[model samples]
Target: MSLRADLRVLWRSPGFRRLTWTRLLSQGGDGMFQVGIATAFFFDPTTATSPEQIAVGFAVLLAPFTLVGPFVGPLIDRWQRQRILLVGNLVRLVLAAGIITLVLADAPVWSLYATALLTLSVNRFLLAAMTAGLPQVVPAHQLLAANAVLPTLGTIAASVGGAIGGIATFVVPSVSDNSLAVTALICAGLAFGASSIAATRISRKELGPTHPLEKLDVGAQLRALTAELLEGERYLRARRTPWHALGVMSAQRLLYGLVFVASILASRSILADPDDAEAALGAFSIVLGFAAVGFGLAAVITPMLGDRVSRERWILICLGIGAVGQIVLATAPTAWALLTAAIIVSFAVQGGKIAVDTIVQRDTEDHVRGRAFTLYDMAYNVAFMSSAVVGGLILPDSGWSRPIMLGIAVVYVLVAIVFARTPHEVRPVPPRPVAN
Candidate 1:
């Protein structure tokens, strides 16, 4: 089906529309929250002057959640998904208030980080629930289109939200950095509250594990969770398509993260005056805006080619495109070049992500789908975090390294070649019997 027709079908479904709105509001708030952090923490000349500092900031934000991410999967499977969505946002709303307080009080930085950590941890669960519940709302036949459209739209919403936050910081007269960041956080908190309200519109059990697990004693629950996670690992290993797709996606994300860090440093040190932190922030936001355009293009292009090309083949094509973008960055490390590369590589990453999401959702059973997506999120974040570490170690404060860019381009090509050669078909694993 064409993209328009697929959207028409999905729009008619009340469940899909509600779920989409929930994601948009939630992710939009996430974007605002993150930009506020960047302005207050990262782009601030006093706080982050070196690549190591930037990497540490990301590690503090992401590493804790990545470590504990697996525990969330089983709960997602066991809990009422609608309740998770509703409660998750409410929790974030409360956390945002705490963060705002810390920012205003000029409290210890660790205190601010701690509050942000809790907010992001809840965010992980909320996102996983949305991805797992997608199958329940849309028709089986339209899953691919839904995947292409929904996530792409959500990403665009985030970019728009971030742009708004950036403008908020600049537009308010005579506002301090702390006050501007607080403004963004206030907006984010309101958005989270609104998202929770949207979540209430979806009926309980509308997005489901058709059969939820029974409550258990703490020890028994721990044992069952371990066993279930093992079983999920085995299931994914047995499904070659989703597993391979995940590997390729992770590779791309890793490289993208490297470029991401470079872009930040480049904006701060090379593109804008090093003394002017707000100017650097504006430059980075422009890069993100171009990247958002890439994401939008992928949404339109992926669905248009859905009928003519297999998703697996499309992934390979995207990786190839990413290689070209990386090559462009390596050869010409200018502001315009970075912006052009951002558009190309963001398209590649977003396109490949849409394909990977569809593959995992289509292949995994609902009983374990929550776990599957949690694993997906883990890999995604870990790859990005790892790249930040690597970029910190290898790149200079200026964030321009031709050799590293060329090397990343080479890796992208190699991954595409390896993925194309790998066998995709595997014997299906029967679903494990659920214990009473």
Candidate 2:
């Protein structure tokens, strides 16, 4: 009954409906685009590429965030948020379609890098705009609920889209000839759909002033963004609690990447059969979807429990769960054992991520949030990228997978120690005046 009531309340909210629906379509498109591109890559005549090449392709797609991210956050503060979103979606539609064209034409692989970069850079910009706008649209009371639900939905989309994408590659033998083109068209269609829905439903009149595009002298804007991003740096340092929280979370990301290395390498070594490979990845994806939805729900519920306990306490507990799960995988002796461990790890890690998102959202301010979160995103990407770089050098048939997984567990524990020392309260409230 309570869930129904919550649903009714959510359903009745015009802003929530528009925001969720738009995000659903757009984010689904984002997920599908990821899937489609991977498929295209496999079919590209340049299949002889390096193992890290695929990683590089995806990394290039995400790398722009680090370069322009600091600026993006401030831009979110300066512009009318919806307009920024509108422009981003439209530009992406073109880029997605263009990528498809180049792929089908069998254009040089060098070309794909630029397309990926453009698509993701615009995505980062739009993502910043959306993050700043969400608080404005939802009732303050439901903010946490809203945040939890959307990411939940997005994660589910990612899992499903990945599955669908893999299947598309398997089933569509002819898809390779124009796989990139097909990916582009589908992405464009999704973008167009999302744009139409948002344009019709979003309340343009309600938008608050942000730094307008014309005033965004790119150079000066970059400087201002740097300043704003720095504002939070002092806050991060002064309040050891939040810094501790960020540290654990950052370490979690690093270990999380390591865990992936452990799993992929384990699977290849232990169950290298062609038939088992697909089954393994598929099983992981399906379980991940379930895990994603569970975590998403937990995130919404977490805020309800927010007043009762410290975020650090929650993170500490979750990290411990995660560390144990990591150990389980590292030491698992068989494929089934590894699968069991993977499921538990997925549950723990995904749940922890949900809480982290909520923590960051609640802790940070809108004005500097884009820069802050973008840096947050950068830290996340960098950790994983660094792990991959290490893997290429250190990875060998001799199997260092267990050692790596154990290392991840150690990183998590060390991070938790730092978090445990952090004070219980650190949500940046303004300084109060002394009573005279």
Candidate 3:
């Protein structure tokens, strides 16, 4: 393709712009949800410290993603992805309202947890739809560049939401209940607006030959669902690729889980500003956001470098950078030092998204993209889930010390080793440029 054609095909495309705007809204809301919930759980007067209660509340939100994997993946493949995205975002309006009202009413904590989980589940599913939709929107040639830019935008939105949410928790009155409610409502409103804008701009014509769904037996469908739920693991067990990638991603997330638990403990123990826990939490994110700024810069550069580097090369480089950064995070002596390390870690870690995602997009087929990407999503989530469950058992007794950090570091190194040894069969091959 000529340079002019490439530019018009990607940059001038209406579908591309719509995808960008909607992603910003969705991820911004994600940052709002996390901050809102943390406020309710950590700072809200009505929250209790019962260990079981904390587990249950957090699990309830995460559970829907785990359980819904089977149905959601098949649905993304079987439906018009944009339609699903529009409907899903619009519906969150009600889900957000419900949680906000319950928080205000001081409803049973279980109700609040359940509502948050449902809203988040819906959010997770729509996110999957969007991921699966991208390749369909852009020509295969532009996949790498599109993947890099969209995710960078989402990171930016998340940082904005987190910072704003943190500040909102402090500034808003009647915030004991209404603060999160207001945040949720804004998120939902933006979601609806985003979906509508996308509807106007994106032509349904480019979506490729629509594969209509066929009916299946109830028992057979159940069996298929069970298989799909375990499909990612099965894929790994049967193949050489995904499991290695999974190991890398899982170890990284396990470290992240430890980081979260450790940061919480470190704020109280090491920093001794137990009362300023909020700032410590904010500090962690602020530093990470600054790092995301670096990722955003890379996003801009990746397109220019697109012809120069293979996507797989970028993945290997990013993973190495991330693993080393995690080591710095584990050993950093002070909160400010950790924050500085965080800036570095964030840049290294985020580059993984575009690289990893491009690999999946190029490697997986359109027919199976939904299942493939959803399973990847599940792998990433289940990694965190497993880490949380296992770490929860270990961290409380261990007191957020080196035991957790070093262990996670070792896991990351192992992941790096395995991925390094992984063969090229499944790795993405960069597209060849056309001579003018």
Please rank every candidate by TM-score, starting with the best.
Answer: 1, 2, 3
> TM-scores across all candidates?
0.94, 0.82, 0.80
Error of 3 at 428 (Å): 13
| Regions more than 4 Å wrong, model 2 | 1-9, 39-61, 139-141, 162-176, 179-184, 205-216, 239-242, 272-308, 393-400, 427-436
Candidate 2 per-residue C-alpha lDDT over 107-149 given as tens digits, one digit per residue, 9 for 90 to 100? 8978977886767777667665666576666665665555556
Worst 10 residues of 3 by lDDT: 427-436
Q: Which sequence of candidate numbers ranks them by lDDT, best first?
A: 1, 3, 2
lDDT of each: 0.87, 0.60, 0.62
Query: RMSD of candidate 1 to the true fold?
Result: 2.1
| Shift of residue 429 alpha carbon in model 1, Å | 0.7
Which stretches of candidate 3 lie above 4 Å from their native place?
A: 1-9, 42-58, 104-106, 162-180, 183-187, 205-209, 214-224, 227-247, 297-306, 394-400, 427-436
How many steric overlaps are in each model, in order? Answer: 0, 7, 0
Candidate 3 residue 191 Cα shift, in angstroms, is 3.8
